[model samples]
Target: MVIFGLTAVVVVGGGAFVAKRSYDNSKIVPTPITPEDFGKIALGDLYAPDPKADAYKAAAVTAYKKDKLKNARKGVAALDWIEIKDKGPGGDGFPQANFPPGSNPSPGSNKGVAKTMLSSFGFGAEQWGCLEKLWMKESGWNERAMNRYSGAYGIPQSLPGSKMASAGSDWQTNAATQIKWGLGYIKGRYGTPCGAWGHSQAKGWY
Candidate 1:
């Protein structure tokens, strides 16, 4: 996930090359990746594949989409879990659903989940209005967004959605999960949805 105040400068030159290589080594894109495959998934690899990203992304998206389609109705109902108004200090969940990992929920799911999650955090539409436009413009709400050049990926276009875990552990295709982290990011850095929206409008990021 993108952090505040800076554009990514992939520092792979000179001495950083070794470190970069090490980081690269942690990535692994699995083929025929089943939902079972996710248990062992390297979220880093899934979000930012290596040189063969085109093919890898296609397969990843296909597999994930199929999985969602299979559980579409159930996942749709899962939206019920997202309640508005932060459930206090630890929030709705702690080390569990509070922050899942690399699971990119469908864009439509993301919206529904956001509404639910944000509401749970004591927020109303006034807080979400600008954010709605920010991502609508960035990915058109596409959870699988991948920049051909920069390789930014997923709903938040986290460049490498793996970084989203820092907001919590949930990173899969769970929109409520992603929205939780995204809202946290906005609050931590910019303090409000409209603030983050303004920054993105001015600097091409949010």
Candidate 2:
């Protein structure tokens, strides 16, 4: 009886040892990340800072302050996505003429104002590029920009110019008013600056 009991104990211990070894071998080991993996990853996947993007943001903030623009109390609703593409057509063709005689020129004058207005409408910093490109193409960010061909006028390029009156009585002179109207128009029509920019990209107007 003692010999039989010893044999039974040995068999059970052997089985448990084999089972544990099998289980250990079956466990998954994670792969280590390599420097090459960064190259394989998507640009959007990396949280790396971009100097050029930061510069653009900084310029936008400066332009806003220069124009003495104020932020609206409201912000945009949650957006599902914002698409930004292309380096954008620079406002080269827009005339260098200054508005209000002594005011700053187009393109440079309204950068921060546009950014602020877009933010009030609930857009992210990523959308600033698209907005800059969109308005650059539209009116060159000049408050006095007048489209003789389409009868569009101001920074937002309101058709007939007077249409911006709903935003403020000083839409013709105030960059903030024009921007406010433009933001409202973009929100109403395209849902966001990126959306308006996308439409402008595809159809040549937003």
**C-alpha lDDT of all candidate models, in order:** 0.47, 0.53
* Candidate 2 lDDT over residue span 47-156, tens digit each: 23333323323332233232222222234342111112111111212112233655554466578877766667888899888888888876777776654323356776
lDDT value, residue 162 of candidate 1: 49
- Report the C-alpha displacement of residue 33, candidate 1, in angstroms: 21
Report clashes for each candidate as comma-separated counts. Answer: 25, 5
Please give, for residues 55-134, the per-residue lDDT of candidate 1 as tens digits. Answer: 33333333333334546756652111111211111111222123234443366767877777776655678977887887
Candidate 2 lDDT trough over 10 residues, lowest sum: 80-89
RMSD in angstroms between candidate 2 and the native structure over all alpha carbons: 26.7
